[model samples]
Target: MKSKYKSIIYSIGVLLLTVGVLDKLWWLYICTIYTEFEECRVAYLSLFPERFQNAFLLTVIEILLLAVAAIIFSESKKAIYQKKASKILMIISLILFGWSVFSLM
Candidate 1:
């Protein structure tokens, strides 16, 4: 793809990321609306317990890993036209990858 298309790809990425992050709020709202349901209460706590939803560092690391994989998928020589993405992704991925590895240590 031409460099011009990179913006579209990034925009879609941002949209998906926003939706993913905001889903928790929506889930909470739903559970509250259905407060009388035993299933809703159980599912809400089991699915979004404090420990799971509050794992910010782990979530960021996972998102970075996914981004690195996406860059590799697009920038691989086989992708040809798709490889037009700026190398900034590669640089960012490298730094984040190192950070994540060190964090896991």
Candidate 2:
């Protein structure tokens, strides 16, 4: 793939990953808030399937996929400077992963 195309693909992957991470955080926050209220907790869980209730697992999978995509993007880039973007993505992913883990605990 061309450099421009690679960058675009990388950006899209990053965006998707960002949205996924944010969604996980939002759901976690909502669940935490409703923990004291059993009825509200059940209602909220009912809104999503059983699989989706495990936001931590889903977010971890997303982070792994995003990391792979970033590696591919960096490898495809002709310019060395573009590799820096991958570093930024990695840092963001790590922080999000840590946040998700903390929330789970």
Candidate 3:
């Protein structure tokens, strides 16, 4: 596949990961959080609490992972090391997917 197409796929993957992280955070708050939803809303709006910040950070990490995957996919076409990098990226992605699912519970 062309590098451009690979790049687009990488971007989409990052977006999906970001959305998943955000949803996981929300789900955690709903299922396990002690604060009321209304209180959470107020605290988040006024204080930008640590939990919210952590979720955003997780999203950023996912974006970085996807960016790395894009580079690996693009490079694999012309470099011998690309195959190894792709395998590593796939493992990382799988782990992240598992964590995301586990977070929902």
Q: State which candidate has the highest TM-score.
A: 2
**Every model's TM-score:** 0.36, 0.51, 0.38
If the candidates were sorted by their lDDT against the true structure, best first, what order would they fall in? 2, 3, 1
Candidate 2, residues 1-105, lDDT tens digits: the string is 565676687776577557756666666677677756665455555666787765456556656665655555455343453567766665665566566556567
Q: What is the RMSD of candidate 1?
A: 9.6
On lDDT, the leading prediction is 2
Q: Write the per-residue lDDT of candidate 1 for residues 4-97, one digit (tens) a residue.
A: 7655755554454444345445556767778576765456556565766444554464566546444653454234533444344445445545
List where candidate 2 sits over 4 angstroms from the true fold: 37-60, 69-85, 98-105
Candidate 3 lDDT tens digits, 1-90: 565576565555455545545655675665465467666545444444566556445555555554555454445434443466555555
lDDT of each: 0.52, 0.60, 0.54
TM-score of 1: 0.36
In candidate 3, residue 104 scores what lDDT? Answer: 41
